[model samples]
Target chain A: MDELSLLRRIRSEVDGPERAALDRGRAALLERAGAEAGIDARAGQGVRGTRVRGMGPDAAAAVAKRRHPVRWVGLGALGAGVLTVALVATNVLGFAGWRGGAEPAAADALQAAALAAVENSDPVVAPGQYLLVETDAVYGNTTNTEAGDYVSYLTINRDKLYVPADRSDDWVWVRSFREPYASFNAEGEALAQKSYDEEVAEADGVPELLRAPDAQFYGNSTVPDFDALPRDPQQLLNYIYKVTAGGGNSADGAALGWIADTLRTGVAPADVRAALYEAAAGIPGVEITEQVANLEGSTGISIGRVESADNSRQDLIIDTQTGALIGERRVELTDEGWGFPAGTTTGFTAVRTSVVDSAPEGGTQNGQFDREGCVDKGNGNFQC
Target chain B: MSTDNEIIERSLHSAGAFAEVFDRHARTVHRYAARRLDAGAADDVMSETFLVAFERRAAFDGSADALPWLLGIATNLIKKHARLEARAWKGLVASDLGRVDIDAIEQAAARLDASATARRIGGALRRLPAGDRDALLLYAWGDLDYEGVASALGVPVGTVRSRLNRARRTLRIAIDPGAARDEEVDHGRIVSASPDSL
Candidate 1:
């Protein structure tokens, strides 16, 4: 190969900083910009003094109506749990006006899903029973070559979490990576095979056990009492904004993403799930992104909001028949930075929650084991 | 649809407009930084690069694109952590040697060959003069042409060409000295000129 290609290949394995890092950088820049614009980001009220560059009268009016000041902090304020839950709010607020409101078809689909959720039985974890949550996910993975440039492949993963009926009880998670589903280029295919081969050769493809404080997916704090959250869709959205303050890119996107996060845990009650769907219906820029979106072989309707800044769409897939949240998927609207064509699925996850009799056994594979879910009672009584 | 120059100019009046610039180039800057430094340092460099660019936007030369300007800023910030970058390169070279196990696996053989070449290139990159390295990487890793490299380095195109030629010779020899001698004789002389205008 030519020296130029060789030089490019040197240290080419490194892709861009992760989504969180890019957001942090953007947040830092915008915060400085907000300071320069004389906006009180902390107060969250800067409508009167704001001067939105290149925006015409109507666009500026929409900004004023929202009363959303430019935020300086990146999604860091949301903390890791909420950030993980929201999956990074696509499309900060100011850009939503350009996309207009939710499509009628999209609104109708969400409303239907809401009604279906209400009709379903309430989800409850009975005593002595464990909540088993399984998710299969496929997303893009990029690797650089010694020949210069980088290639992206579809990485597959499966995670199983067993949550006990008691909040304080131990939780066990099994995480595993599978072979690649596809690749954007030849190099990516080779790299994916190499990765899969190495994984199989080293660990014998055993799923590693993950122990945590609780079985909350994405490290979200304890699941909220669905009955406690406001039932009214508008009030619930407002509560979401208040709770997720200084986090995410835009208020609408964050609200929608907050709903996605809450539902994906596979624990929200029927009423709460219905309310979240109704809340999502009101979000501007909401649309039916995909009619037959498939996740782990399950097909569903993909409803999403676009983060216009980067042209990425964050989708929440809902099974219309059952009103159940199938999973979440992220799509690239345009091939700008990502080396894939438009409509490429950048990220995806399919969740399945069920009640089981007992939790799985744990070993000293990744770390110290706690006696395979055995519990100690008074007088050294052990139940294994 | 606004040109990067237009966006930067607009950002002067409406401070929030600067975010468009960040959206457009932050990843590119971060990727470049990551290639040169560790992930943590790369994040800092990416953040700092845009902050510095925003602060100095008033002095921007109104170029049609902002990537060259942003990368120039990132290159300077990376220079501040030269020691860390050198150490990373040294580590990569060391790791390459440690992988020469006689475990006869055909699957890993091709990767090993490529990895060894990459390590050699990394070592050679560390040894190159700082100016030449910057000029070469800006052109190679940055995907910038001769003029883009010149603009990123704030040097004349002529200087960029010379540095690139010198850097290429060093890399060729590092990758394979025997092939380098024959290739250099066959090709007459190395040139940095690309199809893009300088």
Candidate 2:
């Protein structure tokens, strides 16, 4: 009475009903396949007829031909329509935008003063001091590319700035405006936090407490021999950037120029300004009306703008050295959509910065800086 | 005049010809599916199994019996559909009491002391780690030799041997608890003592 025999008998008994059910299921599947084939044939006929008659193609071509004229006419009519709609929507429907109202100009000046105090104080780059730098950028137009909107943010860390060779030592703590929908209850948060803690603990010389379930060996174990480690600083930076960007690895030449620039001058590089301009140009609805250099110094360049792609006025900062983007703060536009009724009015704001430390003490803070003034700042630290 | 291989090859060229391949392998695929998953979902798995195999026919090496390749595909599909596998196991365990053919168990018990052996084997199999269970099942039920099992499980041959040996030793100790303390027992004897001894 071996396990095999017992299993065999049980299998035989159960198999009967299964076989019958399978027969019935097969019949049903064949019937469904026939029905699907019929539907596919009908769809094919419809597509072929439409293609031959050219009705659908002709209509689409006609629309394409007349689209610009229609859009221009619409834009002319939109000016009056926007005011009435904004009044009705905001006053009656209570459609408050995602952007908040402006603080006092003095408050902004005070913020600048506070930032200047931190920057000018020759503040020792601590493990977690939030660094905010400002820069100005010129964006190029790219309305034809598939990229829906030109969006960019910043990455800050200790290892990224200082540590050039140690793979084990580099760990990023936060990214600026990186996670759009990150919430406490998200499924991956615990896993992400656990990995973060483990990396931090290992770097701090604490015995790694929790090995990743899929990890082959526990703490300080070198990656397997066959696995190729990054050989250069740029490759390492690309790896970190890939992780930070969450699969959106858009580190093209222009973006790389900004990174290289940030590394060199502590200000975002000149090419980043051009790249940002290019990104802005790709967006469908926005137009850059004006670009002016607000401040020029060894630290960075800040651009004060009259209007942006969304028709909301903005002030942008571009770092000259690092080519990393520094900050973008949108001012409320007075003309409201600027002759286009459907244009967005909500303003946007962003700031990017990095701090450098010659020597860092080990805790969780060894090689990273904090990012402030990001819209979703929780714990007042950027989460890259 | 057609070569023998060419004639056999030409016969299997079309979608209809490939559908015959499906009909021939469907039962084996269904059986493997039933073993890995539950009866309720086996047909869908079988259909999908063939669909994938059909799509990948251009890549088929055409040197081996397609049954094993089909089974491999079925195994992967089962892994992807883990919830279905769990449900099938649940259904099997729940229905085991009413469905048990006592005569068969008793006969198997007489030959290999199956009733007590089954209890021991079941306990040991349950206690064995996930990797070990997978190794044992792939070897014992899937009828894959060590090399094939290793390739199927994406593990080294040494790992497969270690896992199988560990599982067999554990089952032996469970069957006769007194054997747990033995120091110099032959590994071959331990493997032979198991109810699944080949």
Candidate 3:
């Protein structure tokens, strides 16, 4: 044989070690990258802010040098986070044991959640009556190094009111406040409250300073006709995957995101809500976090996926005892080299919906209360 | 349906996108590392290579496929274990000595023998300059063309040809001194320069 041909044959022999190498490499690299992406979205409020921050390393370096204005995912947080899962193929009503690799406590929790959802009656909304959705939604916490003195922490809360726009494809958004996770400047002034309809309307790209009779809101893009969603779990999961495929999220991520999005709308159809929970049981990487989410003042258990195309986990807070969605949170799993630190709550949407006749004037405001669902935000600690 | 570059672009905006990049190229990069190092160290080196690739993905040139870039990184990291590679080569060459254990059934299908010559080639490879060896191994093992080798080594295409020529000449001399001849008249070289632009 030719000398060159011999060399080629010898080189080909190295293929022996490749399979084992790929197996080891894939697990480690993917875990870190995958966790970073999924957890960031789940934990942080600033989706755009997080992406923009990742693009600029200088911003991360700036935080690293400082005392780190935000909180990070600690061992305690990870420890407290329940990696519990429950699987039942036939019926969540009573068929226990491992139909899949399902944990009993987690399984019971889900079954109870499903049962609660089934028993709870859907609130009736009449014509001209608004399905008032009050949420202390923190999009994300950004260090306001732009300002001085005591490091003013800014976590812009989206205190919104979603009223149907004459029962059509459109909806009205009345953002009542931009409550800074801050304290009083003077006596009788709890916090600097900015309740401007124009600012909220403009932020949502409504163009008008005030809500017009006909204007499309930013969040209206994801409003689904629940009547069309399948009643079956696997079918619903497929539907979510198919529709959201063109978007950024993975199939697992899409399912998690869709559930949160629908619940936040504050008008999830009763039938759809039950089916959605059942469907959630089938998605891989989903776990029951031991977090009792506080939505303004109410509480619920967090059950959702910690997977994403980014560095955060998206959790849906539902009352296992009552099947009501309390709120949703995003927990950052890895730093994503942005140096934000793991376990940071990147973004959160705390939802509380109440049916009311006729829209309240100026909109419903955030009262003297705190929203502590997953992580503990002690008094005066306003940001992540 | 997204290309690696497209997936990387989307990964910048979304979390799952980066996983797609890993899914596509991790195996190729891993096994390539195994060729340079033992299977155990290859696992670690492959992990390190990808982690570096992911961290620096933002600076990645969007027009290129990530495999050559990834293979290049693997080559650089593997350079640290040059001694391990040398030992592996020497041991394999030694094992090739006085071995006539080719099965009758296998021999019936096999047409020729090149183990001793290949063993000499392997030792000769271990003795080349790190850059030249990188170029050679990339060509021989990376399945990279001239352009790919160049890009992987961060050298010019012309330089890649020179390194390959030099690497091949050294091996040729070790195998058959008279047949080694001059580097200029190696017109018999079947190297596809077309892939040099990759």
Candidate 4:
């Protein structure tokens, strides 16, 4: 979908609760407004600030906490993800066309995926080196506005990915934006090469490996921080739901996506990978599909969820017999008309990953003076 | 209702006049706060927003759109809540459904997909940088245009565009209809340290 429409969808979801909150909150605010103006001496009804008119902030906050409606607590913010599981499970109001399956059996499939993760030995590198993997990706889809004026393009990107020697956060990526993006013009003519080219250039400067929020970047790549991740199924599941992923995406979907993404790097420790699958099983919407998917000609068993945000289904293709993560993809089942049509392959990645002894010529060590400061004293255990 | 600027200008000399300002703009501020925060915290924030605005009326820059200015102040207060009240509000989301219609909520919940669109948006918003997300939310829910968002954010209009643009793209990646396909888009790739094992 187009950016404007997406923004509208996002706004609509938040707007309803906000408007309701408005209805409930207005009376109390007017009372505070009235009290501040000293027009309502009978402020006992709505004015509930316990601290005096001008207490210092800390004291005022303490009083506010006390006066805060006691009935409105977060069910104690339970650490077990009880609320998260309940929220996801209960809120799955069934709108997204849930397909009935032997649902509980899907959990067993996930348990098997975790066991496979435990046995997986992808790669391990010594310090001062990086892991490099390469693949071709198509990043985004098309979107149209109400007036029929549309903005959309699809990119064919060949990328080489690199990460720290250890499972550290940051690394480098080299992207090649190839020609002939899927396109059509404002007038509906085919060769909108300029628009396609602009889209490609928009991604040209994206340092492949990057961080969010701050988006701190270097010349070729960026580093990410994933240090505080949980290693247990429940906590990891809770982390995805209550911590990182919230109302927008399913906890199960996000966890599955995250696990598949992390493992795609071929760098996570086996326990972390195991925990990821175990956590993914805790999500309520999970189902195993009988269909097998082939991306870049690698075929695997498909298990997926109808990911909420776009009414699209995300399938994780796994080689169940051998326990290999072949690949993953998201397919739009409902187009909503103005976006990519239904059955459009919105995204796909076939990854070939392995660890190497050193950074490529244009990678992490390129911008710096040198790595590790290899200064040495004479002994074997030399002090550098 | 009097114009917001008029309400603020009148309140400069008369303390009681601030009530009119509250009556005029409280709902707007409350809705904006509610969009960013949970319901009960929104209530506290809504009241505190106007209360503080009233106390600072003497310093009111009356030339600007008063609601935007108020929203700006409300935005600051919400940030403070985001930081200080994170734990406080995190413990209270379950009980905030007091005013919601269970039947309507259930109806809306019908046929809910595991990866429902709203949850994805929520998840994506959480992933967004606080600065960019603030700009986008202000524009979306705070009823602010680019200038209004700029005014609310205390940044240049260009900065608001940049932040909103960044936010827009990030959210699209999460909510876009096409994202569900191309499984590769989400799996994120790097390399195995021992490719030779193959």
For each candidate in the order shown, give its overall lDDT on alpha carbons.
Answer: 0.66, 0.36, 0.55, 0.51
Q: Residues B102-152, candidate 4: write the lDDT tens digits.
A: 466575453253125555666666667878878877777776777777777
lDDT of 1 by residue, A1-384 (tens): 567655555566676677656655665665566544321232122211122222222222222212211122222244423333443243233222243447889989988998998887555789878788786766565543445244666767676767778766767777665567778777768877887786555455665565544543223233455666877776666566545553445556556656765776676778888878887877888999889988887889999988764566789999877798999876767875335668887666688888889877753322211223433332222233
Candidate 3 displacement at residue A12 in angstroms: 52
Clashes of each: 5, 39, 41, 49
lDDT string, candidate 4, A1-384, tens digits:
354454443324334333333433334444433333221112111221111222222222222222111111111222433334444532224212233322576667767877886776456666876667665544333333345333444445566766665443455555453344454344322323544455345445343232212212222112223455667667666555543232123444544555555555444566776666666567667777645677777777677777655466766666665455666666667754423556665555566676776654443322111122322222211121
Please write out the lDDT profile of model 3 over residues B1-198, one tens digit for every residue: 557787677666654346556656776776677766677777777778878887678777774578888899889888788789888777555333323357788863432444555467667877888888888878877788887887788898889998988887887788887674674554334667765442
In model 1, the runs with Cα more than 4 Å from the true position are A1-101, A146-148, A198-205, A216-230, A241-251, A290-292, A306-308, A363-384, B1-198
| TM-score-best of 2 and 4 | 4
TM-score of each: 0.50, 0.31, 0.44, 0.43
Selected candidate, larger DockQ, 2 vs 3: 3
Better of 1 and 2 by DockQ: 1
Candidate 3 per-residue lDDT over residues A248-365, each given as its tens digit: 3454665556666666656666667777777667666667776676656778877766564565778778888778777777766886533245676655767677777765343111
Candidate 3, residue B98: how far the Cα is off, in Å? 75
Cα misplacement distance, residue A136 of candidate 2 (Å): 73
